[model samples]
Target: MNFFSYLASYFDFDLKILPYCIGLSLDILILYPLLTYFKWHLLSRLGVTLKDKEVIFSSRKNNFNLAYFVNKYGDRNLRIADGLSRKLLHIFSGIWHLVFLNLVIQDTRIAWQAAFVKSLLIIALCSLSYSSNKVFGLAGIMYGATSRIRDGLDGRKNFFIAQLAFLNLYVLVFIEYIARKNISNEDNLIFFSFFIFLPLIIGDALGEIIGTIWGKQKIRVWGVGQINRKSVLGTVSVFLGSLLPLLLVVSLNNLPAEWWLLCLSVAATTSTIELIAPRSTDNFFIPVGNALVCLIFAVYVIHL
Candidate 1:
């Protein structure tokens, strides 16, 4: 317990950081599966054939980007499996954390901590539900739900507004976490502000914007880049998106460059997995990977 305490202090006496990261990561995980389910259902509605082999997926549409998807390692069924694993983990982890929070609150009379943790639990649940629905809606859109709806400026703007609103809410909750942690007096807080907050705002926004614009993945069903689903471009966006958070950690703590590098590596790897992992289960996997990395960081590099 002393060693754990020392490590926690070394990570800046903030128990919330890793847990919050885990929570945020869970949001991403849920989004992945929900989005993928929508995508597949939409494609299937448009008559896209999805055949799975031992470890590969093939679409019957010859001119479609089945070639590219395959090149990217096609395996829809396996992807689905991976996604399920991740989503389950996310639920399990969230429950575990909630239980842990209850125990901590009982043991200590830290008003802010108890309140903040409770708020986090509520926000997390809400975010999970909202993201899940949004993913389904996006899939419905792709499948031509409300087909008469024009894909014009108004529609796109509406979409952008909704997405931005959700993301902003996430940021706001993150700010709440920072406030609850009350690290403002620490010298490192300044670094966290610029690196963490700034980058997160930019990265998530840019990823969505890019995904909307040049996301040229040929819908397996439509045989064209008709659907505004994820793109290779959007996938690469994670590199820039994740860098902000990692940079924040590095800037604040004066840790070795290797530490930051590792953080980036974890983010990149998880983001990539999220990209390819099946939508049916991504809600589970993304957080597990992200939370695992944060915990490892806390235990190994970041903690004293």
Candidate 2:
């Protein structure tokens, strides 16, 4: 047996999935150095190791370049530069996505390619959101794609843009993946495709656009004397905008009247989450929270 067969013999799982893992791994491994070698300066921005520190210089009997192989997280010289770091995280994110995505499609009739594309598109939207700040960036380097989002990948510090990062999208995707398997009603796999994503796309876009055009009154998110304040009209825009997804679900799924009420609940809850969601965690919370609300309404109240 060759490489794949040998590996397969060692680990006992479906052999078909090996190709997915292999292909993704190769892409990440090959692209990482190529991407990072040129942009080593990203290390400093992310507060990781610096690049210009003479690769030939190392403490391992002057034989190894420790920086290249090193790995750690957060403001330190222990890890490689931002490029590889980003790529590594990207690969991790992608693999986890595939894992969850596969779990999502399990027992369902949806096409894997279509689901993968849709999943990537969700990340792309998150990419746009994270880039709402100048010198934009991505989630986990946008699966190791783009550059920094403001002050780099440290989501806790840059929570605003962090919402746009892959972590949030990861949460949304994973939830949908599991929701598909567990939720007792409407398992056409459309909820993940439509209700989950469209709200963010439409609601978020509307919030920004309308807020930019007509936002006047400021609303505090963290409480009195907080720095990050949003406009009332903008917040309203998000609430209204979030409804479109549920409405779409209603229209397409022919959901009962109770679902309409739940849809409204989704919109309202997501908007509220946006307002009070802890600085660094809204991405995961908003989508998952909204989804949970919908599921609860569906299973218990609507009995769908």
Candidate 3:
């Protein structure tokens, strides 16, 4: 089936989840960029100078500005060819990510084959977009090896960088989805959902928000010895981000009240993971490490 048929099948109205799917897509496409630009403006006023890992993303408008880059690319004509192939990639990854959420809330095994289809299709579409949008001088980005942050988005690999960098994460999610096929615990599923989303969303925001507004000192990432783009305040923010959701989980009775140690463990572990994770890969590391910590603590501490 085509993209629309695929999406319609994915979000069958009988499931009554189309709204949530739309919300997730809008969160990634619209809110994500707005927040990125918001940080650029807010941090500029605060004198944080988001020049390093602090500036994680580019504005869609800036990236699509064909007229400005024409002087460099020598392409007098430009076209976006934007559609489901382009937009669906974003929605596909997003909905697949929400599978973890579904596992938590509804005690459902993920539609594994469908999820895989979405993943591969999104990657294919992204690869196509990158090639079509490539400019002459910046064509090298097609390979995903650029070091300079801003340079990658303009190159051929432009949008695929994050996709490759999070290769580990995509594998982990697939593994977890398979594991969930036989398990049946609603609370456990919810735990999985929080474990991924908390660090991915909240921790990410905290790092950027705190690092940009209050952080004055930068430090070399522990595992990434050569990269000193991270700051202590940012690491602390990651910890807080992970910690807050754990608190909510406990409050909601999804986790036991004695989850403090586990909470701190996840916070510290994810923060450390984020600290040393390569640029754009924090989304991968943060959740994987947090998931491991959650399982270990559930078996040892909570059971004890």
Candidate 4:
């Protein structure tokens, strides 16, 4: 097929969801740059100096920003700020999904298509962060704002890896939607989507944030970053965080009695995954692992 025909064929999306998807994409495009610019000032109030801001914003390179933070504030403070920034972004992403569920579309097919478009936009922005070209100023702002220090000195590489984990998440949800024929009902699709994602959103973010602030008893674990330790408190946070929303889901949906077991299983499973999975990769593994446990319960135990 010709290029234009191929483009038309590839994007054969439901017309009902197109406006919402495009609206969300535009919202992100407009708001994110402003948010990042504000975040730099917030970080400055925390400890970042004027020179540090200059280094982060002006550079085409990725390695120097983390070093500047470390030199100014020390490692622990850097971790605190980075952890806060990352989880806030995580929470914002969860809000986007909620918006899709409540306001945009109910069908899994449209939800997946919306997710695919958003992911492409994110991946494209991430790719541009690597470019040395001067026109893509927003790319640099994103790198400076969201890049994690533990991922090493190359902030752009670290940021890109995190986005890939997010992409994996969307892909996993699509796969689950396809494999489970029982979720044909609109309500079931919505429930399934929320069930699979809420833990990753609430549990994982709370685990990291609370753990970073208050976690005293540290345990060693495997991950890509320089720091591979996890806190006992963080693990507990993961469990509780995962469990509460699940209980709410059960209460709201009036799922079968056996679903309580499923909720506990998923919470425990995700906490364990978060503990063991490599540092940044938990984003992918936690949801995938949660889905697997849920699938088993659905097929063999609960028969959802």
Candidate 5:
């Protein structure tokens, strides 16, 4: 037995699933470095990380070099920044979930090629949401903060953008499900509640309410585009609170204990995306992202 067979013997699972795990693990492993290795100042601007020490170095190269990694690993303290990072990390983790779920729990006959296609689709959809949410979400937040909206037009726009994003997500799911011949109302209830409604309502509530209540530091907004809003207390609160509803669902559904891992992954993904994608827009992007994830799970289940 070679590597795939050797591993299969260990888990008593299929080999086709291995690619999914490998792909997700590869993505998860790369996330930190991708966010960290770039320009420190830019990363700081995205609120992806925080900055503490400004290098007063004589050499420009030295100053820039020193600032880079510091921004990546610096203590995250702002609520907004923490929320965004948490949301991004959460999404990445969810992607990992589908990868592992497809490879391990689901059937192996699901060709690795099909799995790759599905993964690509999920990533594309997620990337679209991430980009749009960041663009529109920040615009909404900035508008809310600065622009006058007596008529709540800005809020409406926020809702519209978010709604559009989410609807598109379901469209993709419906199409994908039909393509697979695995569509069912039973799956819909589980998929909708678990991936859609929960992430939007519960994740957001946890991030905003728990975060505001418990977030310790009110880091002064030194400037726009700074991850100055992150707070450790806020992140912990959001992460913890988001898990509550997921736990309840798992219990009520009588899912296996391992399913909790999937739930935890969802909570983490939703929270991180909410933080990073921009405010309000995650309402749409998060659901779409989750829906794509459900497709991956479906792909696995169908093959199994």
Candidate 6:
């Protein structure tokens, strides 16, 4: 049998879904390296040096080259570059989900298969990065891409844990979809997935980027990083960023008034989690929290 057939038989998944899995893998393999290269070049231009030894050792001990930048180019430049890199990755993630969503709307079964494969690949890569001591190869590339957000002393550990938590949410949703097989509520399933991802892609990302640039008032918070201050403006950005997209989706679908309440409630939950979640761990909490709140609201409140 061919590779797709083998995978289908071995994994007990539909062979038709292999194309989506391959496409997502190719996208990550190609785009991720390019984005990492671009980020490295941009930071180098900004005089943010990431020496091999420093990246592997000093960064592990300190705060992922932030101190070097602070000493050389000042905190403002570092923050700007950090924010710009974050925006680039977040935009990529947002685009990826947009494509993934089209497939879900077309065929939930196929989409879930693709998502399950993608999640496994991501978790494997992250696990590999966590085990390696050297800052080279795939681990290096990952570090290059996410070093800013993973700036804490325990950043890599935090990143791996958070990814496990984040991807587990997707896996759980996929399980729910498969178990129910309620074709009538397929559209509702699509909406549920959209609500879970929209805030994470838009609200969480923009909150950090805007906060880095314009946030003057620092509100101290708890987290795993050296920097624990969040901006008032950034918190506002999170709420608005989440709410606006939800509103658009509701309007376009002509969803019920209850969905409007759902939108507002979700936006509030997302921003609140972002505000209070421990540093990079928000990457874990935001989606899972949104999923829980959505489930509670759907089951008890609006009876979705």
Q: Considering only N, C-alpha and C atoms within 3 Å, which residue pairs clash in candidate 4?
A: 223-279
lDDT of 4 by residue, 157-224 (tens): 65677667876744465446444554333334345555677888899889988887778637988656
Error of 5 at 264 (Å): 1.4
Q: Best candidate per TM-score, number?
A: 4
Worst 10 residues of 3 by lDDT: 76-85
The predicted structure with the larger lDDT, 1 or 6, is 6
- Model 1, 205-298: lDDT tens digits are 3443454345554422211122224566656665576676667657777766656765675657555654665422333344344444444444
TM-score of 4: 0.81
Evaluate all candidate structures by whole-model CA lDDT and list the values in order.
Answer: 0.39, 0.48, 0.47, 0.68, 0.44, 0.68
For model 3, what is the C-alpha lDDT against the true structure? Answer: 0.47
Give TM-scores for every candidate, taking all chains together and pairing residue i with residue i: 0.35, 0.47, 0.56, 0.81, 0.41, 0.79
- Candidate order by TM-score, decreasing, is 4, 6, 3, 2, 5, 1
Better of 3 and 6 by lDDT: 6
Of the two candidates 2 and 4, the one with more favorable TM-score, higher being better, is 4
The reply for model 3, stretches above 4 Å from the true place, is 1-100, 103-108, 111-118, 131-159, 165-187, 221-228
Query: Pairs clashing in candidate 2?
Result: 137-148, 139-166
Q: 2 or 6: which has the higher TM-score? A: 6
- Candidate 6, 186-219: lDDT as tens digits: 3476677778878988888788788877887379
Q: Which residues of candidate 6, in runs, are more than 4 Å off?
A: 1-16, 49-66, 130-136, 149-152, 174-186, 300-304
> Which is the better candidate, 2 or 6, if ranked by lDDT?
6
lDDT of 5 at 193: 36
Off by over 4 Å in 1: 1-205, 219-228, 280-284, 298-304
